[model samples]
Target: MLGQIDITRRQAEIADIVQRSGFASVEELAERFEVTAQTIRRDVNGLCELGILRRTHGGVEPPASAGNIHYSTRQILNLAQKKLIADLVAADVHDGQSLAFSIGTTPEIVMQALTGHEGLCVFTNNLNVAFTASANPSCQVTIAGGRLRPGDRDVVGRSAYDFFTHYKVDIGIFGVAGVDEEGTLLDFHEDEVSARQSILANCRKSFLVLDHSKFGRTAHVRGGHIRDVSCIYTDRPVPQHIQALLEGSETRVVAAQDTV
Candidate 1:
């Protein structure tokens, strides 16, 4: 799996173009980037293989499915942005608080950021989060029981939902698979949506943590709205459409860069 650092500048730009515009032909991308058609094809092919883009008849487009990218790839994609968001979330977190974390790479990064905090009670269905939070000796970690998903390193389903229903935590931090234009919170699986809903219902303050890439993305399962969360933490300002949806609501948007 190629990390963010391994992706070339041209390749990265190509990905951005496709993601934003929906599709870009080889010739058009080459002309836009001032590269040869062959070079553009190479880049598109590589991205397609990584599941970052899907190859069409004469162009490349964002993956047209409800499923998310592979877990290994997701771990490395936008890693720096995720870390920045994590730092912001950690800074807002104080010691001696109970936190409910949901499954996803960003939340795992948050767990890493919170490792220095003392006296935390962490409940999560993500094994990665539990392991990271356990690094802090003063933290108490309780993991949900379910069949483990080896690829994502998390547990979901009825057991996970029931586990979260049993506790009301100070903070609930979770990441969504996508946020549509209507502000609908989306996830790839029903189990994931159930677990997230459990966290939102049980937590005193719900924090929706996601990077800019998730702004207009799509997913299969939909169960909540962005307004349901107390705050949103992202690496960049949300799109104007999404901003409009937050109007008249108390849900605060926090861009990580603005904190610095």
Candidate 2:
């Protein structure tokens, strides 16, 4: 078995490459990392055990599914990367801004990062985000009226959608379950899609926050396109084909690694 640190770093890199490219052969991975094919296999096996990657005949690819991972598990996955993306996003937000935040762990982190800002009005369906944003005494937090989703600590449904549509916000920050190969945003449930659509439509500036692992992942509920957002804050550069699509568009892609 590989050392804990080594295994984590290698597997994370491998997962990112496979997610962005759709698939990666063992030989290609071994060559790219200057490691033996056997070592690459070991890393692949570990990722497969985590259910994030599926083994192919000669390579690995993201698991094909419409369901998202457990919320607790998602909270810790790529946490460091999410924090970096959040910090960059919070830096762009000024005090006294009216913001709408959609549900997700990354959005919660962004709210946490904004707790120091004063005179902000935050609208959200996510209980976690509401609590975090309220930590700033000067910020006013409004949560939606809907049945709580205990698993995700958020609310979703017609009520959530209507709540977001009622207010026009200066900035809308949201996260998606996946970004398909065609650059469409996806989520596990129709309610999530509807709520996110309302956010995008009502905000003057929309920001999509996601880590690299979301790039080529699969989800059944389609909402919007990547180009629909005003800015994308992610941990890694987008795939080549996605980059080509964003060219000359109003959307700005900000990778934390490039900025730092």
Highest TM-score, which number? 1
Q: Per-residue lDDT for 1-260 in model 2, tens only?
A: 10012346777778767866989999999999999999999998987876668999999988885568755446656878998999999999999999999998899888888988999999999988888877778999999998888768889899999999999999999999999998999998999999999999999999999999899988898998999999999999999989998998999999998897
The C-alpha stretches of model 1 lying farther than 4 A from their native spots are 1-66
What does the lDDT come to for candidate 2?
Answer: 0.88
Q: Please give, for residues 1-260, the per-residue lDDT of candidate 1 as tens digits.
A: 11122667677777767766888999999999888999999888888887778898889888875467777557656777898999989989999999999999899888888989999999999998998887778999999998998778899889999999999999999999999999999999999999999999999999999999998888889989999999999998889999999999999999977777
lDDT, candidate 2, at 147: 88
Q: How close is candidate 1 to the true structure, as a TM-score?
A: 0.78
Question: Per the 3 Å backbone cut-off, how many clashing residue pairs does candidate 2 have?
Answer: 0
Each candidate's number of clashing pairs is 0, 0
lDDT of each: 0.88, 0.88
